[model samples]
Target: MKINVMTDILEANDRIAAVNRQLFDSHKNLVLNLMSSPGAGKTMLLEKTAQALRGKLRLGVIVGDVETARDKERLEKYDLPVVQLNTGSACHLDANMIASALPHVDLTNIDVLVIENVGNLVCPAEFRVGEDFKIMILSVTEGDEKPLKYPLMFRESSLLLINKIDLLKYTNFNLDEAKANARKVNPNIEIVDISCVTGEGISDWAAWLSGCYKRKFGTNSLA
Candidate 1:
């Protein structure tokens, strides 16, 4: 009975996600769902990405959190279209939550829409909020064994950003082992090491994001 109920819930969410995907396709907008554990620099990455792609792309963000509007406030500094979805007690943001927020976002003028899911490595991976791709972040401080313990996020994500590399000297995290473990779970996952504080590898991330946006829109304006 429990399994059936869970399946039904996911089916319902997928239905809404399909509707959201159609809306995004109509406007030729690429939506990215970003997920990570708490304090994994999700907002910091979003801030940097928004600033880097400021004039080149019509970028927008939907910030999801269990409480607080702090992430939304940080993103607003970019001066682009931003919406904060407070999920109250929900651990993760589902397609229904995204559908509710779509009414507030002007999809026509937006080229890329990034939904920053709640700061969680687990539950968020189970829900699809109608995104073209899923991007997951894992900080070095979280340890290299995370991929094996929490494989679903790694398996679901198309891109993985291993953040906080600058702090490697202070910790015992092994980059190769982390990559290997993630690859074991998701052989096709593209992983990049980045540090939001030191500005390391931010350019590659920004370029890749721009490329994705262009691929969906099919234009050379970003280049």
Candidate 2:
């Protein structure tokens, strides 16, 4: 009989993700698993987030890429505790990869642990990596039909950041339509229009993050 190996792998990954979740909960760290397609501004968002939260949050970043520490290098300027995870042939960051990196990061003092998953809309959304929130970045340059084309990513994410709004004037993308389509897939998803380059909506993003961090950790200051 034919077997679904993918199901078995996902189940195993989820178990590990549960364990990782407990570990993060113990420290009260708000772990956000960020996913997007290539050139969706994930790195720039991280840089801008770090800048916006400067004295308010203590951050740690784990960058997952198919190869190279390129994204990690880009984030180094922020001075956050950054770890680079090269997934080799793997296209997504599974729970085991996160488990492997946990020890390398200083979680005790971290208020938030951000996992910038490898740039893909499919597999990353399927694998659970012990995150409190799954955030997806959709740039207007990708066009507005993305929510329908990539329904799973839209459906699974807790927050959707409609990034690259700075390019709206140049593209045929409809902002309201994209937001409405995303809501169709996931009614509960919280979304924001942002441009990491122009520093727009970053303060709101940071404030949301800080509020979530405070709620999760139950503290106002970085411990």
Q: Which has the greatest TM-score? A: 2
Candidate 2 residue runs with Cα over 4 Å from true position: 1-9
Clashing pairs in 1: none
**In candidate 2, where is summed lDDT lowest over 10 consecutive residues?**
3-12
Q: What's the distance in Å from true for residue 181, model 1?
A: 0.6
Question: Any runs in candidate 1 off by more than 4 Å, and if so which?
Answer: 1-9, 221-223
Report the Cα lDDT for residue 216, model 1.
78
> Model 2, range 119-162, lDDT digits (tens) per residue?
99898999999999999999999999999999999999989999
Residue lDDT tens for model 1, 1-223: 3454435758989999999999999987889999999999999998888777777877889999989888888888888789999999998999999999999999887888999999988999999889999999999999999999999999999999999999999999999999999999999999988999988999899888878877877884433
TM-score of 1: 0.94
lDDT for model 2: 0.91
Q: TM-scores across all candidates? A: 0.94, 0.95
TM-score, prediction 2: 0.95
lDDT of model 2 at residue 39? Answer: 88
